[model samples]
Target: MTTLHLEHASHAHIHGPACGHTQVPHGDHVDYAHDGHLHREHGGHWDECEPDGHAPHEGHDHRHGEGCGHESVLHGDHVDYLHDGHRHAPHDGHWDDH
Candidate 1:
């Protein structure tokens, strides 16, 4: 993971189940995938959300790639495969929860 400066959204729009965006559970909060970036609601505003560290997916023997039978999302610098409501990215000979 990399250090990222979170930026607030310009518009005053609330994100939730009815927001029509993909909701991804990250840590203790839910992230909304919008306009090719992840957004999280904070203090009546929206902030850009990014992972803070490498969270390895233990016991993940399946490798994700072309024809892996999962939806691949283009995250920052890598591709994340959506599996069972979680996003998995390939890293360090294993998969990381991104």
Candidate 2:
């Protein structure tokens, strides 16, 4: 089994999204907060995601460039995500981005 360690180059704990942006995967619920990739549990085990890019919750098969979720941390000023080994802005933040 692949032992995946969940971590980051830098870890900043934000109480909530700078803006009101939020992402709730189906049944999952979330409050405004720092955005971090989640570690999903599947069949009493952890999933080994592709080394090329990120993955969603277990049981869902998604590939790079194929409807990959544009999940981001409302960087307080804008919405951005890490993809292709770099951070990118997905949208221009406004007052009512919630």
Candidate 3:
């Protein structure tokens, strides 16, 4: 089972191949923001299978190379505020502290 946790602001999306289920961690927040209040996010689907038609238990490369099927976040109009592994303050229109 491969678990991937993605969080942005109060939104989050969790994906894995444990029970063949891919669920968004945002829960009720996703439903409430369905009326175009938020941007429509897209992501890649991760599986527990390898290229050799076997389970990716060990010796599997999880790199961000081509064909690795890695998910990435793309920021469009909104300011991308990533607070992973660090703390950041909300600065209007500027991400860098000067």
Candidate 4:
């Protein structure tokens, strides 16, 4: 068991979901940044969701920025995380594209 904290590390949208991309869904622990919130792996699966409707995590109000290239901007409940200079969204199993 590992306890990881949030950091300003950028995650390319390409490293995100595979609904329409080549990247596969996360099987191991994968931390995600969306809408100023962090959804990490807790308990047994990636059940630590942080959608806008869900309660916000304390002291979690910072974006990971564009370290992986392209910019990430907040877009309503989901985030328009960019990759390859194009806007892309991560696949949170609980929600679809909005």
> Is 1 or 4 the stronger prediction by lDDT?
1
Give candidate 1's TM-score. 0.71
Q: Put down candidate 3 lDDT per residue, 27-89, tens digits, no spaces.
A: 221211121122224344222221122232233223332353432222233221222221111
Residue ranges of candidate 3 with Cα displaced over 4 Å: 1-27, 31-61, 76-98
Which one is best on lDDT?
1
Q: For model 2, how does the per-residue alpha-carbon lDDT over 1-98 read when each residue is reduced to its tens digit?
A: 12344433333333233544343221232333334333233343333221233323333232323245755544455544444333343322211112
**21-79 in candidate 4: lDDT tens per residue?**
32212234344544454455444333323223332223322343457454555654656
In model 2, the worst 10-residue window by lDDT is 89-98
User: Residue 14, candidate 3: how far off, in angstroms?
Assistant: 24
> Which residue pairs in model 3 clash with each other?
none
Residues 2-49, model 1: lDDT tens digits: 425586648577788999877877767787877776788877778888
RMSD of each: 3.1, 12.6, 16.5, 13.1
Give lDDT for model 2.
0.35
Model 1 global lDDT (CA atoms, 0 to 1): 0.78
Give the whole-model CA lDDT for all candidates, comma-separated. Answer: 0.78, 0.35, 0.26, 0.39
* Each prediction's number of clashing residue pairs: 0, 3, 0, 0
